[model samples]
Target: MKMKTAVLMAAVLAGGAACFAAGAAELAKVENWPRWRGPQDNGSTEAGRYPVKWSGTENVLWKAELPGKGCSTPIVWEQRIYVTAPVAGQDALLAFDWAGKALWQTTVGAEKPGKHRNGSGCNPSPTTDGVSLFATFKSGNLAAFDFTGKVLWRTNLVEKYGRDTLYWDYGISPVLTEKFVVVTMMHQGESWLAAWDKRTGALGWKVARNYKTPVENDHSYATPIVVRQAGAEVLLVWGAEHVTAHAAATGEVLWSVGDFNPGGQKNWVAVSSPVLAADVLVVPYGRGARLHGVKLGGSGDVTATHRLWKREDTGTFVPTPAAYKGKVYLVRDRGEVECLDPVSGKTEWTGQLPKSGANYYSSPAIADGKVYAAREDGVVFVARVEGKFEVLSENNMGERVIAAPVPVGNRLLLRGERTLFCIAAQ
Candidate 1:
């Protein structure tokens, strides 16, 4: 599928400006998931009251069969669901209806495939701006497709931008802004964060991360989150060796901090992206387990003066910490769920999950006074978010879930190992 070059400039509105559906109402009210984590990149949802408990046979509104396997989270806009998959030698972009029916599946492109584990296809999640859906693959192929599976425009990041050398594969999901779609191409030789025209897939500009050590595929897979810092919007990126900021519009490096780990380590991987709450930035790095919070201030190069409160040995390399209220909630790889004060980096409360294993890849989704977590053992646990963790409900889908669940309206859209289910209150 090839997209036409018709780049347009229109401000994408939040979900609140729409009509009311019985379960999910406005766009912000619960429709557009947009990116990996929900709106605002915070995991917390403006979605209506979703159910606290659901099983395979209970409260399952519908179950749809996917075309192929993928770890990419499902993105929704209006009444359509978009997902990406690679079939045979071609990458397929499939669109499904609200009732769990396949609408159209189109072949986007085919290229040299990257290595992924446990049937995990490309980790790129599709991003929509309420009008168009933007997607990227492990092969460094990025494209913009319409609501239906029609391609709009495409670009080969490896050919145009340079080669992608990320260790595992390209897992960073793209984010859409008012004028451009931002992508993180953290690779060797050409390690940078760039912005492209949202209407047409044209390069606007790129800010390079001039690293002392040669660029490694081990740079970062962490997605960029747009934050309002010091009265202006800044894109925050955290990965292998550094945490930095860039102008969202022009791809200019606003500030940076490097040498996060003194002795360069290969096992060290930054899978979790940066989480922002107000002026404070909660950046987590692991395999060694360290989570830090830096307050944003100053102009170009704020690494020396802006380094603030850091919490060590408190996070997993996979689960990105979600910040709400004044605390940050996290789920370790072994299923240790805890809440910590973002400022002090101190644990407020910790709980040993019922289903514990080393295969936990899903992140904690907070909504309506509860934290929803899904594990590899086919379990979904709900705990009360009251500083002290309280297990309220334990639900299961009887399938492995690697991708995080997307909260839309009052329903929870979960993509398991073999099925895509919509669970909501009956």
Candidate 2:
């Protein structure tokens, strides 16, 4: 199951360029979901006219049955949709046409089954820079591919840096910057943030990000968010009970904030990632019960200086909060939805969806002021978060969903347990 130094990527191609995909002139105007958090690195896509009501049979433009189980969210560039899945027990990346047809399938290597019931070997979503795309598996294998589904290069992190010590499966996806594709490893031991050359797969930089925390608190499933501050790229990482900012170019720790667990709580691993609302950074901690708001920028040890506001009553455990129009929208695991002012940490409004025994692991997404959320039992809900919180619709997909709902141009994409569905306004 080990990938050789010079990786072997075999792609089975189909329809080319996903024909009639992106209009040539409008291509520059189109808002493609290049990464998991979307084009803006937040869950909101202000350009799309997503479906407000949809079901397994209704409003579905096309539905493609997936070849294997995957929880990774699909990323779209133009009309080409890229997702990771295990095809015949091998870790592979699959491409689909805009018409919901398989474009190509490329095998990376053997799959690493998840330890959690809802986990998978393809938890990390694929990221693309329009020209080339990047994907990483739980096996620590990261590979890059061309838009035609040809493997450009491959590298195995676990093979180079040794195995991860996280309690559960790796959940962080690869993030693309101007010149590098960066990834992070946050665990009880040997935590680090590293970047590699986007074109040649060469090691660009690696920075140690280890921290001490209570037992099991060091294990983090949260994904790092990339943002720009002071006109330069910076990475906001949440893990090991600390929030740190790193120089995206040289992998240098510019500033750090800690003391998240003041009471020394144990087993409070970070799963829900940090989200940025304007210039304020919102972090969910206290195992989904507490939330924090911090002001962006400053030098080393901004723990006391950048601290803004915090909430002790409510937070989310699994679903990363989404920010739109400078407000934070959080869909708690148990169905409680809260919209807050990111700068002041003030609760603007709160609402709840239909009570379900199942929880929400998919991060909520916002499109044109509407919040799209998915429950584990396959029920997707749309809530309007403008003047007040209002439940718009609860559509059932008839399967499980752990990936975040993605709203691309003129359509909303939902990746179910065994299928990929595209919903459009009709």
Candidate 3:
């Protein structure tokens, strides 16, 4: 009778495990843009269709005028949309509902206004893990809030660490991993990468990320990315003349690639973040004609051997590359778009996007077999991700746009200079 009871208990536990696995799989299919670069952190989404054509009035579902200006992209989770703005001399994180109603706005820290021409205090994008939202500002403040707008915890990195000395304002967006909110603070003075507990805002680990580069070249506005390799997850931090991978659990430097800024140009700042495609990781350097493709699963400096390929004359200056469906899409600062093979770094196609009197700071968003590249002067050129460089539509938002468009479900969220416009099918 005792043996029979043990068998029945084992069967019950097995059934419970199966149910939990199924629930996790179902949750992954919910389609939520929860972070700086969407769910995958590569500026691409599987949410499928998004409206290709939108004007100032046509196909725009709703437009909410923000209090002040921001260049960070809006992130969405379930029915809530969160964005950061510098309003009334404060760095504020605003929340909105699905129907474009303002839910709540909370002041996170004092605004350290950008000194550069196109920079802002709220340049870093906020990231969410569905339960809590994390935001960072140029003031070096990091805050966390629950989905219902309750402030859970807040801390200022500048208070703990030293002052940031970047040429422009700090713009590296926070990355939320399963266990921590990882942040890379690379600048001219006392650079480091630190991770904090997402729930309690406690420091989990910190590592000094000093790089032996020129003063101006030490500044990096690129964000860190998380990638999975060999059944283990690794966090990648790009900038400071190298691309370093850290162990996601302990903040240990696993490997690095340093040939990106070989000649040590004083003005070579890393603006674009690394994008991972399958087993290859593409790292872009500013003012360079080539981008490096490093193969994953290495221990030390893999610059000599692990490099799969390098594409000359094909690097982006400001916009980060997007990888989708085995192809990497790059939008240059001067309105040029190139699609290259991820493994070999071979150019598949290249063409110029529609000019809007300015350059591009926003990265390309790939969804529904289309690549959406937004220009600084408020024009978004939607092109097909197929044979040839065919443009499907040219969308004009009629305002200065610097943030990448967020695609969720059948709608696209575009944050311009003063308004957040939601575009959907008419």
Candidate 4:
């Protein structure tokens, strides 16, 4: 008991120092990919002179080995990269250096294995505020840790809210706002969207969920996105069967669109996070697998009022679609790529990838003008997307690529089957 208390105190002090250090806005390296889809989550890599052509043999920076299986995306801050893994009977959180050296590995909690197909385990991606990293464990634990593997604080969402009653494992990554850290635990009876004090882990506001689906898959792997409009901030949440807009300052539900479709028994579901650009929320929804684009800034069932356009066939449930400029690109699970105009939802072009029989659960990354798509069979498709499909280069890593490749300037940080490789051209 004394040892636990001492460790807890040490963690608290370390957490305070990390939090009060400074805001990441001024010191955040624009070149490092900090989150799932970069800062804006539009899959945009704005760094000048990004890698256009590279393979496992060429322009290789380094590769670090991980212990277990996890589909969590890698996030970078400064000189470190963080990833979560579920190995043996423990869920481990690992930090690696820029040179692919192992820095620290902290095991968070005992694993509570659940039903998950397709080699996906503990799918929650890690999020960082440039100083401290926040991750979710399969045992229903949400923890924050410092750079040197010192745990700061942990909150078991299952103990607080209740156990996870979902079919697949939890996959929702925590999103950090200015004042709070927002998370979603969408269970059956006590489902809610809650925010905690970013500094102290105090519960801020938790709103009871009103939306429920008939399926036992009442779990959302989509992370929350923050959008500021009209001088007000709103957190966009897409869960099991509903997409909701909430007040960031409070836990009030501003608007929601329910009646979600999650495919079928042998069907795919919408696990991709939503994208926002030009004040318009581009969500690829529907269970039978259709995509919809809705304009924001409305109240109460805005589906009829703010829906810009609805596109079918080209949309995907797992791969989060990408929107840039006036166009949106959708990568289906079967390795098919389609580019559409976001304004009209019209398909610009569609093409099949070279690697046949490859499944694409990783989202496409758009850097400069090139699009990067990593397939499940370990092939990275590099193509030029301007008006038509032009394959630039196809890089094969020879391992299963499950997590999305994070674009950090000219370097692409890719986490493969058992190793994380940094691909950058000289």
Highest TM-score among the candidates is held by which one? Answer: 2
Tens-digit per-residue lDDT, 1-426, candidate 1: 121111000000000111123434333454677777877787777447778887756777788776565667787787788887766667777787666777887776774454544325457778888878888877777888887678899887777766665455567888876788888765555567788898887889777764644334245668877876566667877754677777777877777776566656444556677777655777777452777778775676676677676656677667666766666778766778888777666778888777554356676778776788777666888888864678888887776676677777777788775577887777
**TM-score attained by model 3:** 0.90
Q: Ten residues in a row with the worst lDDT in model 3?
A: 6-15
lDDT of 3: 0.77
lDDT of 2 by residue, 100-183 (tens): 778799998888877666777788889988779899998888999998878999988889999888666788888888899999
Model 2, backbone clash pairs (residues 3+ apart or across chains), number? 0
lDDT of each: 0.68, 0.81, 0.77, 0.68
| TM-score of every prediction relative to native | 0.87, 0.93, 0.90, 0.86
Of the pair 2 and 3, which is ahead by lDDT? 2
RMSD of each: 7.3, 5.9, 13.0, 8.7
Query: For model 3, how does the per-residue alpha-carbon lDDT over 155-214 read when each residue is reduced to its tens digit?
Result: 998898978876566788889778999888877777898999999999999999988787
- Supply candidate 1's per-residue lDDT for 351: 89
Model 1 residue 68 distance off true place after TM-score fit, in angstroms: 0.7
Better-scoring candidate (lDDT), 3 or 4? 3
Q: Could you tell me which residue pairs clash in candidate 3?
A: none
Q: What's the true lDDT of residue 250 in model 1?
A: 82
Q: Between 2 and 3, whose TM-score is larger? A: 2
